[model samples]
Every structure is written in C-alpha cells, then in structure tokens.
Target: MKQVEEILKRNHLSVTDSRQKIMQFFLNSKGALAHADIEKKTGENFDRVTVYRTLQSFVEKGIIHLIPTKDNSIKYALCKDDCEAGHHHDNHVHFICDECSKTICLDDVTVPQVKLPKGFTPQHAEMVVNGICGDCK
Candidate 1:
C-alpha cells in the first residue's frame, strides 16, 4: 500500500481503486502482460476503458513501459531501476516464450551497448529474445 502510494505520488497521479488495483496487478505479475491478459485475470467487473486509461497513465509516469510485439500487440512491463520521469533505460534483456507467449525480464543479462552511425542518438533499446521458456520446454 505504501509503495503504491509513493508510486502514484511520484507520478503525480491521484490514487484510486482502479489505479491501486493496476499497481497491485503489476506487482504480482511474473512478467509482462497484454491488456487482454490483465482484463482476464482481474475479472469482468473491470471496465475496459478504465484499464486502458490506467495503463496510459502508468506509461506516461514511467512506472511501466510499452513494448511493441511483432504481431502488433503492445505489451506492458514493469520498468527497471534506471527508469526516470518521462524516460526509461531498461538496460535488461527480455525473454519471450513462443510457446507460452510469456514475456519475462532476464535480469541477469544487461543490454550491451551498440555503436550507431555518426550523427545518431540512441535513447532506449528493447531487446527481446524469443524462445521456449523453461516451464514450457
């Protein structure tokens, strides 16, 4: 509860039931989740618009990040320690299991720096390695 409050306060968002519930869901999640996944797990009582707006708020606040998938489905994941207001540097590799469609943060693997062509500036990088997760194997 205290953590939730602090997160909301830092993001300059007012605390609400939906926000708190979303925060708790993120905390309990083992990996990244799709919007539909969240709606399914939380139950039907949760409004779709409410969840969408809540997620948008979280993204803007840097509490989480939007990861784009090859299939065009956007996934949300918790931000790492390097994240800050309006900007985030995850610096961690992500593992996406093709079998289970699970997106897990591989904390042990830090993202390696890449050399870009001159006159190019890099902000953040999203590296996801797709394979069969241990549980699915």
Candidate 2:
C-alpha cells in the first residue's frame, strides 16, 4: 500500500483509494489484466465506470501500458521505471501462455528493430508470442 502510494505520488497523480488498490493489484499481478479481471480480483468493490476511469488515468500517466491481444480484448501491465507521461519504454516481447491464457511481459527479450518503408514514422511497437508456458509445458 505504501509503495503504491509512493508510485502514485511519483507519477504526479493524486493518491486515492481506487488508485492505490489498482496499483497494488498491478504490482502483485504476474501478467497483464483486463478490465473484467480487475473487477473480479477486487471483488467488484469499485464500480465499472470508476475502474475504467482509473485505468485511463493510469495509462495517461504511464503507470501502465496497454497490451493488445489477438482477440482484441485490451489488457494492461505495469510499466518500467523509466516510463513516463507520453513515453513508454515497454518495447519488449509479451508472452501469452496457451494453457493459462496469461500474458506476461518478457522484459529481458526486447522487440527487434523493424525497418519501415520510406515516409513512415514508427511510434510504438508490440510483439506477442503465444505458446505453452514453462509451467504448463
């Protein structure tokens, strides 16, 4: 809880109960989480609208980064310490476990550089590898 509060403070966001709880959830989580996942984990203590707003705020503050899955269901995971507003350094590979369906950040495995066509400006990149995780395998 104290660490969550400090994170919020460092991100220049006002500390609130919802933010603290959400931050703690991310900190303890092993993989990215969807909106429904968070709701279920919190026992539905927070309203859907509140959770949505909190997620948006966290994304804007760079406390978390969006993970886009093949099914189009968006998930979020904690950002690295260097991530900040308008800049996210989570340019690493995300591994999705086939058995458990968990999406974890492979921080050690960075995304390879891609050469784009002329006149194209690359902003951000995401790479997700789907396979059986070590535990499942």
Candidate 3:
C-alpha cells in the first residue's frame, strides 16, 4: 500500500481508492493485464468508465504502457524504465508463453530497427515473440 501511495504521489496523481486498487493490481501482476482482467481484478468497486479513465490517465502519466496482442486486444504493464510523463522509453520486445499464456516483457531485448525506403518515415515499432517462458519449462 505504501509503495502504491508513493508511486501515485511521485506521479503527482491523487491517491484515490480506484487508482490505488488499479495500481496495486499492476504491481502484483507478473505480466501484462487486459481490460477484462483488470475489470475482473478490480471487481465491482469501479465501473468500466472509471477503469477506462484510470488506464488512460496512467498511460498519459507514463505509469504504464500498452502491448498489442495477437487477438488485437490491448494489454497493459507497469513501466519498469525511467518513463516520464507524456513519454515512454520502453522499446523492448514482448514474449508470450505458449504453455502458460503469460505475456512477459523482454525488457533487455530491444526491437530491431527497420530500414524504411526513401520518403518513408517510421514513428513507432513493436515486436512480439511467442514461446514457452522459463517458468513453464
């Protein structure tokens, strides 16, 4: 709870119950969490709109980042890097375990840069690898 509070304070966010519960969920999570997962974990304490707003605020504050899944659904995980407000420094790869169905962020493994053709520009890139994680092995 203290850690959650400190994170909220450091981010200059109000320490609301909904925010605390949602932040704690991320802290206790081992990997990325989907919207449904967060909704389930947060239980009936908050509505979908509140959860959505909180997630948006967190992302805007650089408290978390989005991961694109194979199903096209989005997932979120805590920012481990020195992510500042309005800027996320995470450019790492994401690994989804086949056996356990867990999505782990490979923070040390950066995404390879792609070469674009002339007159073309790249704004952002993401990489995802599917395999069994160490815990499952």
lDDT of 2 by residue, 1-137 (tens): 47787788888899998988988888778888999988888764898998999999988877788887889899998855533343557488999998999888887888888999999999877898999998897
Q: TM-scores for all candidates? A: 0.82, 0.88, 0.87
Minimum summed lDDT over a 10-residue window in model 2 is located at 79-88
Predicted structure with the largest TM-score when compared to the true one = 2
Considering TM-score, where higher is better, how would the candidates rank from best to worst?
Answer: 2, 3, 1
In model 2, which regions exceed 4 Å deviation?
A: 80-90, 117-119
User: How does each model score on lDDT?
Assistant: 0.80, 0.84, 0.83
Candidate 2 lDDT score at position 102: 89
Q: Candidate 2 overall Cα lDDT vs. reference?
A: 0.84
TM-score of 2: 0.88
How close to the true structure is residue 66 of candidate 3, measured as C-alpha lDDT? 86
Q: Write the per-residue lDDT of candidate 1 for residues 19-110, one digit (tens) a residue.
A: 88888788788789899987889764589999899999888777887666799888988865523343455468888999988988776787
Give candidate 1 misplaced runs (Cα > 4 Å): 80-88, 117-121
Model 3 stretches with alpha carbons more than 4 Å out: 82-88
Better of 1 and 2 by lDDT: 2
**lDDT for 34 (candidate 3):** 87
Backbone clashes for every candidate come to 0, 0, 0
